[model samples]
Target: MSNSGMAIRPVLWDGDVFRVLDQRLLPHKEHYIDCDTSDKAIRAIKNMAVRGAPAVGLTGAAAVALGAREIDARDVDTFMKKFDRLCDRVKRARPTGYNLEWAVEQMRLVVVENLSIGIDAIVEKLREKSEALINEDIEVNRAIGAWGKDVIPAEGAVLTYCNAGGLATGGYGTALGVIRAAWEEGKKFHVFACETRPYLQGSRLTMFELLKEGIPATLITDNAAGFLMQKKKINVVVVGADRITANGDVANKIGTYSLAVLAKTHNIPFYVAAPRSTIDPMKSRGDQIPIEERPGREITHLGGKAIAPAGTEALYLAFDVTPSRYVSGIITEVGIITRPYTRNIRLALQKEAGK
Candidate 1:
């Protein structure tokens, strides 16, 4: 996913020991750690080496598909059992992002749906289908960017929280893609990047990515968004969604809800840039969106540096939900959707989903 005219990010491959841009080394050393085993992949996902709902989901499916290749199965039923176990294992790695679990379940459904095909063929198709899912994300994100670009002001500042860029997707990113498209269209705008707490994905990843593209951006402490709003440093608050409920409520980075609130008080436009896949029509509202409770170590330390006394337990939440009512618009790859997204958005997505 290219944000602000950066570059294309490749999808996870079997032989490719999927390396995560060690978020811990960010703002200093931009490093990527290689994940070679299911164990390594599990650790990476747990450690936030690989995150973002879409990326994690893709990785979970890829990990299972690759793990299936390693299973020494003598028969089709054995392969099925082993593969099911593998998916279950990946599902346990992270339970917050329903996407990860959802993808695994989806892959399983694919396997079950095509059960008529032998295990040998099933394995091959899983790999093929998983690869296609990654490709589909890129295409969807690109379209979302194209569509989101129209909603952004021609010349104004845009605000975002957390990391939603090439590093966060199998290809084109949702929120970052919109920024990239706008930048490419000769739009001169400053990007206000919030330094998300616990894990500063914005300070570490988002800022680094924008700098790579030489885009103009300002770094602000997550709490300072309200001040920025009062000062009128921002015109729009654009965030990426981990999940969007049927009512259009969005689950995103922890600080996103605060930003949405600030934007609402300041009367600024708040938008959610995501692909149709991010929307969960099954859930009725934000109350159903699960929040990721992170390890306490994140709050007590900044990267590898200690910011608190030794062994200080800290409360950490990886996500928060912004009520749909607070959102001005939802910028999807398809287009900008307004309130009452009920029937239209779902119908459109259902059509795209082949439902």
Candidate 2:
């Protein structure tokens, strides 16, 4: 949670206010959207002002807590009704990331347990629970880094797609965390960041983090990834997941599947790094995971400029699923999950729970 002295944090809670780093305008403009109400927080998440699975989850919890404080309910019953509705609204803000639902459920449990105490007590508990979630996210990410760093080569190029650094989570990142940990351990290597199209998160956010931390990194276009691997420049591929199905399938950025396939063909290690909260045990397979579709404007334009003709229409799929077969391993907070991911993921979660 200390951030290893990093300057940027995606989400911050100071007193009653939630200040979120507006990721939509990153790497250039730095601004925080002040959210005092759940609606404001929800909008931030919906608009990509505050994104990433872990960050969204933390935002949802904070929203519930803020909603609990803002709702004008005279009695416990009325308060519970309003708060529960707010929880559902926040959960629905984004459908693909299980962390959003997972965080709401965690906050809901806090409300349920303290409902009998009084409305004020419930509100206070919600605040405490929301803070707990934020702190837990950073801790889990650090643990994930410690567990995953071993996979990084001693001196080789490590490729990452999208933005999964401090800007994507409460503090440390999932895939980037491993890279940072490895770098901290004196593993001198170059990092290749893919300029993820449409969103350009890798170019905008990931590159920003790497530069900030003084990590050696190079930016490449989305299409240039295969060429880099073919030239034997990239050694391993690591990416963060939005949701991991029960069968070990991963749903991440739209182009993640293609990268995974390329890594498999090149016989390179393809790893997914994320906390256990991202693993949705309810979804049996990747096909079962809901892929959120975005507006055509995202694809038809770039940086607020229209690049296509007026009549052009584009289908924007926010995420794509990668079958477990292509994944060399899944790095979690507890440990690395290898083959038979179903069994390993279950056992890892069970162990984490038992702890």
Candidate 3:
């Protein structure tokens, strides 16, 4: 299945500019923000104009390409020095998502391998590398869907959090990709999207994609998940990860750990769907994965309107970690990784590397 027809594309490279579908206006207005410069692209990633792990990674690669073009260096060594700095900045845009660093590193390798080539050729190679990341992400997502669809029950409800749809990837999604694959294979299932709070990516972006695809879905508040699970309304739980540690621990949207805990309590299967790029082998544990902290205003305000007292203090931790013990399986493009996660996760990644 090709992702050519995916209705929602969160990131686009338009030859001249990196185009990001402004997610903040989603479910209300569809808008695209054009980033012709690296700074603009970095700002888009930082401000959540374009989000999701895979999407941000692809955008970061594009930012490196754009930054490469702006380098005034005529020699390969000088260009690489500037390019390294650019990659560092892009990687720092969002610390939680491994894909950002992974994607930028991929771009960096392209330059390193072609150092003998002229600076102009390296720039062109960076462009090609960014485009390759886009295509590769779509293909990887489709493969993940193929492997993960089997986990979806023939006819049951699947609970998901945040926006892991086409809007979250190059095209097809991670968690939502599994759902989409099952749907395409004629398996009937209802989706319950948790309205991920403070950001509302689930209610806005996820629902928007679900409705566009004509999928049967319901929107639920973040805290209502356990009640629904108790009522047996939820059959399985699946979510996308910003980063997966070597031990198979997952760091995702803020409320994902809660869902995982609830799923475990209810004896429901909890799964994480992501491309291999989202895995950080360097991080041996979840705590080693940096959790991004957003501004308190995100919690105290909604759509630029104040919802709390002027001095109300709020803690907006953008993500939370779910231990491998809570995860039933991890669906990757390579395959579904099951426990003993420490060993299995390594084998899965080695398989992905064609080792």
Candidate 4:
């Protein structure tokens, strides 16, 4: 499939040598950053050249494998030691998205699994698996999109927070995936995208994506959501999750919790679109999921432009959690999981993982 001026290959794609969509110059300036070297890859990730949980995760493996390919050594031990350091460093670029960490862990397992299997074999398997990780996310999103399409009312308004669109995942998306499916299904649903304070992922990215697809949408400030809801405009709330706890708590773009609260006050249904892997069993509750506090500059600026004159301080938080009680359902690739997540989420994962 192809979109506007771009090709829709598998979700996990590679741009020139090492360049990724320069999100900083988006919706106005279309650009990509090149990072052929491991060090350069680290800088790209650190500077937000490439982001979104699934996107970053695929990039993580790509960067690591790219680094491994650059390793120069005759001795396997020496080569492994050197590449390990590079891989570990790249993994540190983003500490919040578990996908980055998850991809790294998968890459490491591939290396171990291929031991005594020869360098060529190891590299081949890693490459295949890395690519598969991306395709896996794509397939999951497609399934999620199909199954999640029904969550939205047949003819009602829906609200989404942040930039969980095709750019956020391998291809289709997460919460936005549902929207895509709805569009495909000929559902005439109105979409309200939050500007996602401090980051503006919604305005800068989500809006861009929806417009690209010719989807009907309206952009609004994060605070103005309640007013729209008060007018009985928003009947359902659908957002993406970076991480979800065993207890059903969700962590996503910072203003998401506020939306959830507002939805509850207005008796609107709040829903979360997330992949199964995001469900962390180790973390028993939302409190355990690591909430990333971005640099203070994010709150004081826009698109690398300083809104507050020079030297003004900024307060930034990359994510926030919404308790399960505020959410009505969690749509996954397998099916939709409704409230009372304490055990149902865990059980759902077990059943799917069993497959």
- Global lDDT of each candidate: 0.78, 0.91, 0.91, 0.78
Could you tally the backbone clashes for each prediction?
A: 3, 0, 0, 3
lDDT of 1 by residue, 1-355 (tens): 2343336353456454555555566668666666666677677778777788788888787777767777888887788888889999998887556578777887888788887777778878877877788777777777778888876777889998898876678756778888888887888999999988877789888888888777799998988889989998898878888888888888988888888988999999998887776777788888887677877877887747889999787888878888888998888765777867786577667554322
The C-alpha RMSD in Å for every predicted model, in order, reads 2.6, 1.5, 1.5, 2.7
Pick the winner on lDDT between candidates 2 and 3: 3
Question: What is the TM-score (0 to 1) of candidate 2?
Answer: 0.97
- Candidate 2: where is the Cα deviation over 4 Å? 1-5, 353-355
Estimate the TM-score of every prediction.
Answer: 0.91, 0.97, 0.97, 0.91
Between candidates 3 and 4, name the one with more favorable lDDT: 3
Task: Write the residue-wise lDDT of candidate 3 on 1-355 in tens digits.
Answer: 2434377578887878889999999889989999999999999999999899999999999999999999999688788888899999999999999999999999999998999989988888898889888888988988988999999999999999998988899989999999999888999999999999988998998888888888899999999999999999999998999999999999999989999999999999999999889999999999999999999999999999999999999999999999999999999988899999999988898784322
List the candidate 1 regions with Cα displacement exceeding 4 Å: 1-11, 14-19, 353-355
In candidate 2 the C-alpha lDDT for residue 327 amounts to 96
Residue-by-residue lDDT tens digits, candidate 4, 1-355: 2331123322343532544676766778777666666677667677776667777777788777767777776766776787688678877887666677778878888887677777766766766777788778888888888889988777888899888887787777888899888878888989999887776789988898888888889999999999999999998998988788888888887888999999999999899998887777677888887777788887677767888888887667788889999989998887888857877887788676213
**Highest lDDT model number:** 3
